[model samples]
Target: MRVLLAGGGTAGHTSPLLATAAVLAEAGDDITCLGTPKGLEVTLIPEAGFPLELVPPVPLPRRPNADLVRLPANLRRTVKATLGVIDRVRPDVVVGFGGYVSVPAYLAARRRKLPIVVHEGNALPGVANKLGARLTTHVAVSFPDTDLRGATYTGLPIRRQIADLDRDALRDEGRRYFGLDADRPTILVTGGSQGARRINTTMAAASRDLAAAGVQVLHAAGRPEEVELDRRAGDPPYVVERYIDRIDLAYAAADLVVCRSGANTVTEVAAVGLPAVFVPLPIGNGEQALNAHPVVGAGGGLLVEDAAFTPAWVDSAVVPLVTSPERLAHMSRAASGIVRRDAAEQLAQLIHRAAQERR
Candidate 1:
């Protein structure tokens, strides 16, 4: 079967699509990724050894005047590019993960009468996914409570390496790889893939406090600021990195995690059963907060508002958990309860069924 997957703009949107593509490709299906030239997909898709078809960057307008001026032109360009790609590829099915890039591809697929499936990876649907849902025959979701009508809770598709890790083996490997004392608890801090300035700064300020309390920190800062923070931190027990390629290793290594509440991050955290302190990005209609609510409500993690996130709060809230074995263990169990490691395989099965029905 030939499948066309489209999504981009950030790693949050693209990574899951890539994971799904990897599964489909391994199963002997032909896959081509369509995305904007400027998005993270340009770098990531090619590196994954797949064909990437570039479309023009279509900016979603924020203001009415700009929307009126640019909407027609942008739609026309998007339709042209999408139609051109579809004509050449002639994919049997089109699957969109969320982003502005997905909209045109979904529309184009509808025009061609191809089967369309959309994966909504957030608790609150984005404009693109909302539009795509109407055109799609199936809507798969990461969060169970997403308001997309007729959507199924398929969980988030994660990389096979992560999905397949044995919990006990992961814990053992994590301890050895990071050289943790095994007795002392570890805290994993990340600002998502691009890194969060607020999170980084807050962590930097709280690093010494963490060290003094005997907490080992593995921080993925996502940029120079994190590296600088690492340099400033100095010595063993505290590790800092600009980016982490082996996220499975990080997840396996961490006892407690502090991170953004992006859909993928939450799913990965749940998959690995690591407890978290989530500071959702305070932007774009409070979607991150919406994503965190389920985990927080389930007692898997604590949701700290961006406005309330501070070194003092981190010390007060996270320090006690890191220092106390009983609390940390309890939270870990709570986290494990939320993860669905077989999500990718399950989603793939659904897609396969959908494709077959379309044929």
Candidate 2:
């Protein structure tokens, strides 16, 4: 099968799109990605060894202005460019994950009368995906009860490492890899690729308390230099790094995680059955808050608002949770049941089915 995937703008959209593409490519299918030049996909897609076709990004302005006035013409040009890519590739199906690029790809696919599969990775469907879902019968969603037509709960197509993670089995090796104690409780703190300023600073301030509690911390501070902080010397339990490429290791080694509740983070954490303290991004349309709602409701995690997730809260709440074996075990069990392990494969099957309909 020849599949053309359209999604970008952020890792939230692109990560799942690439995960699905990886499964298809491994199964001997030809895959091409359609993304805007400005998105992370420009580098990530090519690095993943897939051909990426560029399209102009047309973001819908929130308020009426000059950009709003230019929306019609921009959409026309982007749609034309996307159509050109579709015609040249002659793909069997075009799959869209929600992003600015998806709008044009969805429009082009419909004009060509091609089979379309839309995946909404958030609990709240974006404008691009809401529009795309109307043109296709095949719709997949990460969270259940997403407000979209004909949506199937496919889960997020996470990276193969996360999907296949066995925390217990890899715990020792992961600990050794990170130079953490094999016996002590481990906590992983992260805030996506760019790192969260609030999370990094708060985690740093609370580091002494966490270390005093005999818990090891793996803090993937996204911007280590930007924040003026220092790791305590003398065999410190707090291991701080600018970034961690092998996040699988971090997950395996962690008994608890303190991080942002992006769709990918929530799904990946749930998939691995790791108990978490999810701090949803304070901005946006409250989608991050919605993303972590199910997990927190299921007792798999705790949701903390940005303002409340302070060093004081960490000392009062997080310290006790990490030290309590019984509570951690219960949260882990709750998280373990919420994920579908074969999301990537299932979505690939849907893409194949959509392609067959075109025949």
Candidate 3:
């Protein structure tokens, strides 16, 4: 099968796009990704070894009347550009992962009457997927309660390593790889690939407490310069790196995770059974909080608003939680079964089914 998959910008969109692409590639499908030049997609997509086609981005503006007035023309031009790519690729199916790029892909695919599969990675559908969902009966969602027309619950697609990780088996090796003590409690703190300013500051402020409690912190500070730790020469390891390319190993090394609740992070953490303190990004459609809800509701994780995740909260809530092995074990068990590990495969099958039925 030939497919055109669309999404871009942050890891939230690109990570799932790559996960689904991996599954499709395994099935011998010809996959062409649609993205704008601006985004992680420019590097991530090509590095993943898939052919990517660029279309002009047609961003949806929150500003009323001004940019909104020009939206129709902007959308039309991008849709035309997207159609040009679609025409050349001649895909049997078009799968959209909800971003500005997806809007153009959806519009073009709809214009050509092609089979369209829409995947909503957040608890709430984004603008592109919301419109795409209206054009197709085949819509998939990461969270169960995502309010869209005929959306199926097929949890977010995650990396294969994360899906197949044996955290218990890899614990010792992962610790040694990161130069952490084998028996010390570990917390993996990340704020996606670019890092969160608030998370960086708050965690940096609480570094002393975390280190003093005999806890090992693997901080994936996207901005490494922002993370200032005041640990003594012999305190429990407080390793800071800009970003962890080997996230699977990091998961193996962690007993708990403190990170943003972007759909991808929440889904991956839940899939790997890593108990988490999810600090939702304090922006956008409030979907980050909603994305963490099912796992949090299932007793798998704790959700704190971004503003509330301070050093004091870390001292009072997080330090105690990390130190408690029994609670961490229970939380890990609860987090494990919350998200499906075969989400990428599920989405791959759905895409193939849509193509077969329409073709």
Of the candidates shown, which would achieve the greatest TM-score relative to the real structure? Answer: 3
lDDT, candidate 1, at 106: 85
* Predicted candidate 3 versus true structure: per-residue lDDT over 27-117, tens digit per residue: 9999999999898999999999999999777779977876798899998999999999989999999999988899989889988989999
Candidate 3 residue 245 C-alpha distance from true site, Å: 0.2
Q: After superposition, how far is residue 188 of candidate 3 from its true place, in Å?
A: 0.6
For each candidate, what is the lDDT? 0.84, 0.91, 0.92
Residue lDDT tens for model 2, 1-359: 89999999899999999999999999999999999989999889999899999988998886899889999999999999999998999999999999899999989999999999999999989888999999999999999878899999999999998899999999999999999989998899999888998899898888778777887888888898644445566534777788898999999999999999999999999999999999999998899999999999999999999999998999999999999989999999999898787899999999999999988
Q: Identify the superior model by lDDT, candidate 2 or candidate 3.
A: 3
Tens digit of per-residue lDDT, candidate 1, span 99-194: 879888888998988888899888989888888888766899998889997798888898888777665577767767766656567888899778
Model 2: per-residue Cα lDDT at residue 134? 93
Question: CA lDDT of 328 in candidate 2?
Answer: 96
Ranking by lDDT: 3, 2, 1
TM-score for candidate 2 = 0.97
TM-score of 3: 0.98
Better of 1 and 2 by TM-score: 2
